[model samples]
Target: MEKVRLGIIGLGAEGGMYAGFLTDGKVNNMVLGAICDIDPLKRTMAVEKYPEIPFYEDYIQMMDSGEVDAIVTCVPHYLHPQMGIEALKRGVHALVEKPAGVYTKQVRELNEFASTKPELTFGIFFNQRTNSLYQTLKKLIEDGEIGAIRRTNWMITTWWRPQGYYDQSEWRATWGGEGGGVLVNQAPHQLDLMQWICGMPAKVYSKVKYGYQRDIAVEDEVTAMFEYENGATGVFVTCTHDVLGTDRFEILGDKGKIVVDGSRKLTIKRLARPESEMSSSMSMQDVMKIFMGHSGNDIYTEEVLEFNDAFGIQHISVMENFAANIIDGTPLIAPGSDGIRGVRLANAIHLSSWLGKEIEVPFDEELFLAELNKRIVAENKYPVNA
Candidate 1:
């Protein structure tokens, strides 16, 4: 009971990474207990690599065997909730991977189920939340360092994937497999961060392109506009085709503005007075003088912060935090309930694009599911190149 015996339920790229690290004892409070995968090759690989650990072709069997105190799902988007529910059903702590699930309905189901099992710790692998850069930004917003948020804009196009990437798996980019492309796969972290740092938008209107640059069936490019409940507006743009992609996130507030580029470098500009106050109080002459840089430097303060690459460390931190939460009474960095926010936002974006109109938060779940089913049916009827 001192250390958590963690079972990993997939041997894909992410699952493999967790297997390597958890087996290597990267997290002091967590040890690799068992590995499970439906793929025979992956099971063989797990056996060859970690012969001491049990290999189960069925996740249910692993959970039923009492070999693992907790389980982390590294499966596809759709299986996350299904497997997580199974883990929680057996009174095992569960840590789900990103995006929660392909849709909110399932994720909400998982959350509702987890709500009943309050004794068990349920968390999601929002590893980016462990990054100091985003942590600082979240605190700044919460602490009102930037007054109230006025606008947010993030353009993250660093997920450049070639055709071979999709060709490797039949379900790589199809609607029936990965759900959506950039938004569902490569951009979930940013989506989670956006809603986490700046509260979820009340409305979202998005223009999405399906397989624009890739040979996939789902969206590969997306541009979404958001309207907050407080009348603040925001924009989110992401795509997977930009080889020289840019990653810039900007949040403007009444008192200051925060900008992050490449997910590491942070820049903050603080104003002596709120923009609302300045707009109402400043005379034309005073504004002109300030605009001319005569007193702008004195009125504004700028700070630049840089963060080292903590990509691997972030994942380790999430795992350790999950274990710590189970071993002690520590709070989770990213609670399993919080995973639905990103999925809901992503659904809004997809629904907005599908309807070619602005969709409100907590939009019609039934309608979205119906529309998604149409695409899923089509994707299955006429499969993609992969």
Candidate 2:
């Protein structure tokens, strides 16, 4: 294809941001052919900025135009699956935003449909995977630098959202609207990163609290423990109500410990062992090089550069990948199936919280959906007058 024609659904914050990337020539081989949003105001706002492109209040209208080769679905959590399914059915590859869907069934359904339609490439925007530090960390773990991981802990209190933020969206905290809170929204990246680095957990136990910091009906705080199949243990704690912010991850293994603070600095203490004895008894000064190598600011810079390179000059990296996967048979950076795991983990956390017990892996999807439906009803009936 000479140029990948693009259509974007949902002209909200994320949609607008991605549109900026598109217009700025960050992604190559792509042209903004059309845009869609249910809210006419949002559509008008986006069109005001890019008046040359066609704007449609309904996504199907854009889809029917057959002018776009690929689609970017930045719609709300609940609509992701529906929009994606439709896009794939229409033979347009899709790049969807995070959490893919609000429920496990929706994710599975999307995955199943995408699997059958191998001609269409589906990707999720788990952009954290693009981070340089995370890439290095994943490389270290894969190369056995940590020497058989044992325990991992992440405390992410940094996502402190004010009450006004939640109030801004009707779907912010309601179960029927946005599903859960921190686990579903702010922490999906962390959960996805954890699984990406340490591997999927065999079991997950969690505790969640609603109304902890806001008037919302969903969780604002979540504490979860994960048991990995490799006998590794993990702890994840996140909240939106913290007075101060904290974003840190520490991984302990037989060889050494790796800690990453919010400052983006990584510290690795190589244990003195037989291998070290053969080399030398290195003090902190001797090991400083290893720490500094991993501590540099290259990762973040590299991530942005890569995204720009891939998307620049016609700005089609995301779209092109989807197109290539369908036409040229390229592998996706973050496939649709991979997106399901994070939501499943989030659901397990919610289930564990509701039952006050550790929930096992491969949770009963039906049971979770049923409980979520009940929560949705309660949330809808919540007294707005009170």
Candidate 3:
């Protein structure tokens, strides 16, 4: 009970990162308990590197080994839910990685199972949730700093991965393996942040390009439109092929607007009065001044917010919070159940693109899965040997 012994399932890129964090003592109140990987090379590497910690090829054995009080699922997109379920069944706290799963249906199953284990801490690696910029923006929206959102747009295409990146692993961009391309891998954080701040959209319409730049079968470029229940609308654009891409997210409300660039600089402009009222009551002369850029200080207040070097804090804070929640009842920053929101949004985007029409927020899971299976079957027909 002194410190949570954490076992990591998968020693790939993400698992290795978590292992490094734990072994480096970057996360407090937690220590590396065990490691698991089906790859013999990873198992050998882990054994040689961390001789004190037990390494297992079978994750189930690691969970049942009584060495770990909690576990983090750092495996593939599809395995996240199933591995989490297995950990929960063994009474171990579970923290999952992003997107929850390949689809909403599987993630729902995990969440439904986790609901019965209230005694255990269940969380997701929505590390971006710990970012101060998004946190402040969420608060501003919730506190009515920007009235109801009129429109929101985010163009986050800084996730530029070369073809070799996908070629490094067989499961990198395959439908049955990684599930999808940019949406599933690179843009989940933005998807989570969008809904976290502005709430989930009522409908989604998208235009997607499959393997447009890369040699993969899944989408590599996408531009999606969102319609909210409150008459608010949003646009989300992302691709992994941009070399010098943009990372700008803007949310415009009736009374104010918020703009974030590169996830670092944040600017908020609060109007002197709501745009609705201003449009109705402003004189022609005042409008002329505003149009001519003569109305300066009296129009609205501007504030810029920035947090330095929070990249490390994002992941470390999430890990520490997960441990603290298990230790002293601290609430999770990103609950495992909340993981489904991002998946749902991603699924909606993919479905909209596939169906060539607007898809409802709670889209048809059966239809989505059926379409997904078709692609998976085609992918498996000529599987890449990684």
Candidate 4:
């Protein structure tokens, strides 16, 4: 197949954005063949606006209709793996949105299933991974430009949502419907990028606040601390209600520091000497001088690189790479298997918060599912307004 014929499930906000690009041929060698949505209004709009393209209320029918060679699912958090499995059953390629599933159980199942289908191209919409800045950061860290990493922190709270926004959809912020709040929704990009850049943490401890900034049944504020295998530490903080929020990702290593001040630009500071070498020469008297409030400023050098809004470009690049991989047998920048890491990270955080303790990576999946099930059952007492 020289050109990919793509079908989209879920004609909501995100799905519609993709449809616009496909409809207008934003990328090369790809055609938008079909769209699926259960809503009558969305189906009607698709039929009226893009009458040439096929429409289906049922995804199964769309998959079997032979209108598309691949499928991209933009459904609810829980439905991603489900629909992707169905797409695979149809012998079609699949690309799913972020936060692979509501919990690790579903994600593990999805990844295991995809692992059996070696012929199909399974991709994830981890669009942020396509950003050049993140690519540079990954390369720098992988190259040991900053030596051994000591600490990592992210304050990604730029997302702002009001109570009225949650009222618009039944699955906006409910544990049963949306799974969680800021972490699952706005923070997945950052979380995915975090693990992608700094490597996954060995353990996580989180303090989560449910509806602290709004009237919802899920957490809108979160602070999580992480411990790495190499004794490196991390902190992740996010909230959906912060005004003038910041998006700063800073990582410190034995050699220097790197910062991705997403609001403005990305920069790196290179140290003159390896921290191990510098500290080896220091005595207890040097420690006393630093303890007595003495510090030096000429420790490192700074370098700023070109940074730009990665919004639309990264999205298009994911689709482009997915097609390229399907056609030319290229490696994926963000494969479907890679998505499970972010899901596991989110699950570990929610589980840590629920259990009120430090949880290790590869935590008890059954326990996490049970805790989620308990909260899902409590959704009855706090029904969605819609």
Candidate 5:
């Protein structure tokens, strides 16, 4: 194939937005040759706009039509794994959106199933991984530029969704609909990035407020604490209620620290001497003198880390890389297997809050599913439309 043909499933807001990447010339060597949506209006609009592209109401038909070698799944939170499994069974490559699925069981099953198809390319739409700013952070952490991490904190409260937004759809901001609130929907990118740069937390304890601001049943505010394998602790806080929101992520380490603010400004602080070295070298009297403020000791230097813009890399970059992986065997920016960690973390948050305890990562999947099923079985609880 000279160029990889693409099929997009679910032409909702997300699918429609990604479709423009190919049509708008943001992604190269990728052609939107097929589209699928149950909504007749979405199909009609897609067809009217691109008559050259084939349209199908059914995903199976789109996969069988051979109109595309790869399919991008941008449906709701729950249908991702189901649709991905279907596409993989047909030997079609898949690029899935965030959250992977509503729960880890489904996502794990999808991962296991996809593992059987080694030849097919499977990537997740973790577009933030393509961001130059995060790329720099990941490199810094991986290279020990900040030494061993002591604590990580990301107070990302900028995902302010209006009440009218939830009213736009019934299956949103509900357990059975969108499957959790800001944590699953608006915060998945941050959740993924959190674990991506630092590493997955070993245990998580959270306090969540449901319908705090919106007239919905799911959590709109979340404050979670994390325990790492290396004994480091972390905090994650987010809400959709604050208007003067902020996005600040910082990783504190023994040797230094990095801080990224709302303006994408990155600040670095490096220690003049290791805390261990300084403490060990100083006498108790001297340490007490400095501690008592009788003497002063400067231990660190602060400076801004500078880097050039990365040419506006974002969703299109992920898409282009997906195509390259299928065509030239290039590595994916986000592997589909890694998508489950975020879902697991989200589940742990929900579970911990529900039980009022700190839950460990890889928490019992069967238990989580059972708890989810209880909610789904409630009268008019789960959104059938979703």
Candidate 6:
């Protein structure tokens, strides 16, 4: 087996986490060939952790060196599309972090670039897809255990970030650096999960607040209503202000309801069993007992193991998929094209809040881009002088 040589850019929080996986030999069949970070301290820290691997200050120089087969970009939200596009142009597979880009146009460009290079793989890391509970939920839905989901709701408030956390990095909360607050940063996984399970929305109405929790310019609290194409309604509520928070997803269907409260494990209330199997006469108590027995466990471990099995253990599954697609013709888990949905939805929410209107889906990309650029330019006026 030819080991895949991997390079990593942006040694921030999630970057370091991926680096740890590579260095710890948790992921197999991949070598950490090189690492790059603009920060001198981060570069030094990475060198210290993996002495065999070379470090570079400039990612372009690292890419030019021709030392890596794939690049894991854990850079800021705005940089994901550019870096990923550059990697594909260079014939290097790219695995980018979530909320792939700041705007829809950039994502479309990246996807078009990747499409032209069919040999190149491009993947976005929406790691929550690996969670066991989520997998089970998806499976149940797919299996028609919940008949035609009519309504869904997710309250994701567990992403509490303190003032010090945002203060630690100049790019943390600012629009110019990170794009948006909880929606762009922390809630991409949740958004991706929603899209994965419930599919895209046809219409959206949102209310967003910036200083609801902290003094940041981007929204910290959001309540968005979604009308799915199938006439199913959904509500997404997220906040970084809640000190005592909860992450919950509930799907209400004609036949039953599936509720996943991040704290209380997973629960399913089946209104009625399948007619074909009704002869079993398993009472509601028995059904509840069975459901409880099979509910939440440490699914994260399972996700990691699956990632290891599919792609080399050291490689992130999404990145591995990208590499495989390039090298051996595999499919992308979350392609660059699929990456824009969350950010588009987030932007719609922001736009709706700003304009005081219910933003329609399949929004005007040019208009949104211009508005976002204007907001970024305005915010950058008093840039964080880190």
Give the lowest summed-lDDT range of ten residues in model 4. Answer: 377-386
Clashing pairs in 3: none
Better of 3 and 5 by TM-score: 3
Report RMSD (Å) for each prediction in the order shown: 2.4, 6.4, 2.2, 3.0, 2.8, 6.6
Report, for every candidate in turn, its global Cα lDDT versus the true structure.
0.91, 0.78, 0.91, 0.88, 0.87, 0.76
* Candidate achieving higher TM-score, 2 or 4: 4
lDDT string for model 3 (1-386, tens) is: 76899999888878898889899999998999999999899978987899999999999999999999999888778889999999999999999998799898899999999999999999999988899888888999999998989999999999999999999988789898888999999999999999988999999999999999999899999999999999999999999999999999999999999999988989999999999999999999999998999999778899998866544778889999999999999988899999999999999999999989999989889889888888887866433211
Q: Is candidate 3 or candidate 4 better by TM-score?
A: 3
Q: Model 5, 1-386: lDDT tens per residue?
A: 66788899988878888778777777886888799999889878997887788999999999999898999888889999998999999999999999899899889999999999999999999988988888988998999877999999999999888999899987887778788899989999999999999999999999999888889888899999999999999999999999889899999998888999973788988777776687679788867886776653375677786555554458888888999999989998899999998999999999998889989887998888777666666626664322
Going through the candidates in order, what is the number of backbone clashes in each? 0, 10, 0, 0, 0, 4
Candidate with best TM-score: 3
Question: Whole-model lDDT for model 3 versus the true structure?
Answer: 0.91
Error of 5 at 111 (Å): 0.4
CA lDDT, candidate 4, residue 170: 83
Q: Model 3: number of clashes?
A: 0
Candidate number with the higher lDDT (2 or 4):
4
Candidate 6 ranges beyond 4 A from true positions: 273-327, 382-386
Runs in model 3 with CA error above 4 Å? 381-386
Q: Considering TM-score, where higher is better, how would the candidates rank from best to worst?
A: 3, 1, 4, 5, 2, 6
Per-model TM against the reference: 0.97, 0.86, 0.97, 0.94, 0.93, 0.85
Clashing pairs in 5: none
- Candidate 1, 1-386: lDDT as tens digits: 79999999998899899988888878889999999999999878888899999999999999999899999999889889999999999999999999899888889899999999999999999999999999999999999988999999999999999889889988788777888888889999999999999999999999999979887888889999999999999999999899999999999999999999998899999999999988898889888888788866556799999999645899999999999999997999999999999999999999999999999999998888888888988866433311
Q: What is the lDDT of residue 48 in candidate 6?
A: 76
lDDT of 2 by residue, 48-73 (tens): 89988888888887888887877888
